[model samples]
Target chain A: MDRQLDQLLSSAGRPALCQSVLPALLGCIADIARTLRTSHTVALAGTANAFGDDQLNVDVAAEKLVRDALAKCPAVVAASSEEDPAERPVRHSRDAGQTAEEASSEQYTVAFDPLDGSSIIAPNWTVGTIVGIWDGASALRQPPAERQVAAVLGVYGPRTTAIVALRVPGAEAACLEVGIGDQDFRFHVIRSRVRFADPPFATRYFAPANLRAAAESPSYMRLITQYVGKKYTLRYSGGLVPDVVHALAKGHGVYVSPVTAASRAKLRRLYELCPIALVVECAGGRAIDPVDGEEILARPLEGCDDRAGLVCGTTDEVDEVKRELLGASLESCR
Target chain B: MDRQLDQLLSSAGRPALCQSVLPALLGCIADIARTLRTSHTVALAGTANAFGDDQLNVDVAAEKLVRDALAKCPAVVAASSEEDPAERPVRHSRDAGQTAEEASSEQYTVAFDPLDGSSIIAPNWTVGTIVGIWDGASALRQPPAERQVAAVLGVYGPRTTAIVALRVPGAEAACLEVGIGDQDFRFHVIRSRVRFADPPFATRYFAPANLRAAAESPSYMRLITQYVGKKYTLRYSGGLVPDVVHALAKGHGVYVSPVTAASRAKLRRLYELCPIALVVECAGGRAIDPVDGEEILARPLEGCDDRAGLVCGTTDEVDEVKRELLGASLESCR
Candidate 1:
């Protein structure tokens, strides 16, 4: 059941590493989710993810299934999981026959939130997995979110799906790459919208916020009231992945997490925000910090625990969040 | 296939008409939902329901399927649908061999809201079908909501489900059925929670409200703010069927529709509120009118076009809505 992560990746001199890992990652996630769906028991596992959030037994199993599968892959150099409690990242061994040259060139850093929102699985609400792939072991030297070269969201509900995005633009395009350094990563989505119908949704726009937390603050409360006043609908499922991907499939709406006095950021920057922001931004949508308007994917990964409120989705809604939550003027918000 | 509705009845005037229609109606709804789910086109049908609401093609097809099926049923002497724009209710013919004496005793009335909230199919959010069955073709004689004898909710999402309920108790009990008349209709749920996880969702309460509409008034704004302040989650899919069903499945949480000045009520009392309220109440949950503290199913279906603000879900959350929105005392609201 375990596949070496590195063997699935291509060397730097060869094709893109994302090409090999994409399908493998998607397969691993789907295989695990499908198996869990058939099991009648979906209760809490008395376990939690790295951030101490309670994990469902199904989620704990899905996390292990993915961690073990990726950890066995030779291409996966350093791996971090939302469910893994270990302080040091898990580093997989190179394949038996791999030469040092091949090992160094093909190695990848893989970070993932194995079962995002597994709690919803009980009532069979839509749930998903989110993964971020970075080039080489450097994913460890600096913050992992900043180093992510690819991110994918896999949703399993009424229909199964793998929404994939890759940074494939070559060195020639230096514009968006400056944020990611010399990697010259450009936004490119490989797949999207599994079983969801194509867009033409009259007024479906997602605004993911903590209602209780929002009400405590006047500014955040204003943003929420304004969204409702505009007659905008929401898709806040208490899970980050499903909310973001729902909007992604519809090609509209915004998913936001605003900072409140009690909680600086509820979503993990690397496991939650980075992958979603990358997918959204690549889909002709916008992903930015609610505070400074910096690209969400480019937010400096200050540390493993670094967190910043994020707003992601279509330009219109994100623009609204920027103006309302951050007080960015309409002129400068977009 | 259209089955004559009358032949299914006992004709002996056994208990009531609901007993005969419950099984047939559930079968009809389940059949139509399952068929629509497999169709390739999940897009909008470019048509709308009677309320001037947009209809998904799946919904349009589902509506036709239910109307046609019920029309052939002999037990269903009179039938009306949310999608049918006709002036007269469709009437099913009596069995070919039936005499006038038997026909008079066997006939029943059935009203349905087929394909409730089909628009969310674009994003594949949970959607459902609701049906309310009443005795006598005279269902047209009174507001169909007040005439309901039995009801069902069919949810089509990660799974297909059939939830049925009947008023088995005699009318002598004034505690729960004053709204349905001396018919002594009792509360009961046939089936429920096709895929939703069991209760104890920590804080997974779904408070479905019309945010924009709520904000138009001060009282509604206060209620919504209080919900947020109390840290309530939401599942407002702009569809009464799915939101109410979601809460029903979770076995906890609350779903509400408070009165607004501009709009009397958003959900149809006859087709939507009555059916869902029946299911939730039968499941050990509660459904009530935020204004008068009357049971939702007990609301006199004022007329065909009657709509009302509703609140339903687990006891605690609903009690909160009654107290905050309707100013009901702790003991009086319950």
Candidate 2:
């Protein structure tokens, strides 16, 4: 039965690639989730967050699961992120002419933005885990400037979805499309959050983006301001993984590029969320070019690389952000 | 030095008391504090708290520490709380009621509130932890309601303090009181958060008798209120252990006892903070007794135990409350 279930989920993502490892990933994810649930539910009376630090408060089992996976898969050279720099193999002292055996072994590096938007843990906000795999040999040889990534994947809960991006032939040619919302993710396109054709746009706006881009986009800015004025709910997570996870789950998204804002600069990414974009696209959604649709944007090295505006929803809704970028005047959906 | 520190901490409390096991408790506290400082040094990535949840995110080190202590202490009967209900032995049980030689051993049951206020993990709130030690034999008995605890202890940090309670005698009650701001504390009088210059004066004001007591006793209330609010930064741990620890560190204090509008019941204790009042008094903090300063009040299981409006804090403040309850106007202290 276990083998059959594995075959089913594996078959769900065809071509017998790493998808064959779906069962293993799922098992790890489940183990971590259950461990986390138990820990929180039964934490000692006064003990909170498990550790005094906020980042360490993340699912301890989640970190262990990732660590275990990395250790077992000799294919993995490094498995860690801003949340965990400990996973980086320590370099033995060469000053003393240390032998090769004395030096730590190099393995595949799995860089991650672990538990992005974890600040929402207190209020139970949407959070996510993302891992980007880079080639061990190349990663070690290249300077900080030249690390190329092979694959990136992420998962989120409430309704767990596993999104992956593989650098296969015909991949990374264009701006990625994004698909989010509902279990039945049959993809469709729409222009923007506002639709002169759909039900009047009456909900509050809550996406993590640069305040500057949000202000520049007249439609989104007006909606956001009005929503804030009405004292409607607005939550912005400066972290990328969680922000995007939330946007997809909710069906309508908004992100501004070239933010020119200090606060939003932290959300910039080079090679990360693109794979997530691939997953979104596969699900029949669109990730519009933050800039001109014609010129494919390269991941920025220093800062705000993918800061171009991002809006994902049904294909048509996201097109609105694209339309606005293209000098297209949009009628208010309301 | 480690042994000396342990001996110094264990001196006043019962030698076999759970609180006497100061090594693990203090070690975990320092570990948490250090982690918090390191993680929060830069722009904090996410919310973290001092405590860890056992059910949601188990801390292997913490579990091992508590388990080791429970095993070494025979005086402990059955410990139970948010972490575990059954009295798991320090050693594993044999399978299916078989002797150890006959089958694989079963896991021991250890009940602990590994880390409380776990909700703080997400929003970056102050968290604390508690562990109540009981004998395994007693734990194997019936319901938790039937078990009698020998000692309950707690640690709350970022203003580190150890608060304890024990049923044993000749135990010079002590509290690890690290004065906030000043960072110096020793055994001292308890204090309150609400006070009134005179009683009966505010009979028409706040609903409960306790609030009225504060309104009535002007000078005493002022001292208690200021100490309660400014001293602890108005932090409340729904978890009993941290709250008790915080109170102990500040010479003892009180939260507003929840009172319904219609029932003019004199306040005996604050809502969630009530359960630990006995433990607080046992630790040498005064549990306000309207009629007496030294006595601790508990509701009679049967009949009208309706003693309303007690005071809790440093013994001095409690005495002050007792004086007011006797209808004497407070005398000014130089």
Candidate with best TM-score: 1
lDDT score, residue B326, model 2? 47
Runs with alpha carbons beyond 4 Å of true place in candidate 2: A1-21, A38-52, A57-61, A74-80, A84-109, A133-220, A223-258, A261-264, A268-272, A288-311, A322-334, B1-334
Per-residue alpha-carbon lDDT of candidate 1 for residues B1-334, written as tens digits (9 for 90 to 100): 1122222222223333433355445556556644543342332222112223434455677777776667556566666667763225555544423334435555566667887765555444556788777766645445433455567676554434445554433431111110000011222222212222344556567655666666576667787777677777765555566566556555567777777777567677767777777667656677888768788765456466667888887876677777777663445657
**Residue B144 lDDT in candidate 1:** 32
lDDT of 2 by residue, B126-244 (tens): 34545433323433332322222333343332233334343333444333222111111222211111121222221111101123233334533444334332222222323344444
Give Cα distance to truth, residue A163, candidate 1, Å: 2.2
lDDT of 1 at A223: 78
Q: In model 2 chain B, where is the ten-residue run with the lowest total lDDT?
A: B200-209
What TM-score does chain A of model 1 get? Answer: 0.76
How much DockQ does model 1 earn? 0.19
Residue-level lDDT of model 2, residues A1-334, one tens digit each, is 1333333333322222232222234445444433432232222211232323643645454666655544444344445454444346523222333234223432345555545544333222224556655445323234322233333333332222333433333333111212122223221111112111232334323442544344345544454344333433233444455445434433334433323233243442333443344434534455555444421123322321333445443455456445655444233432
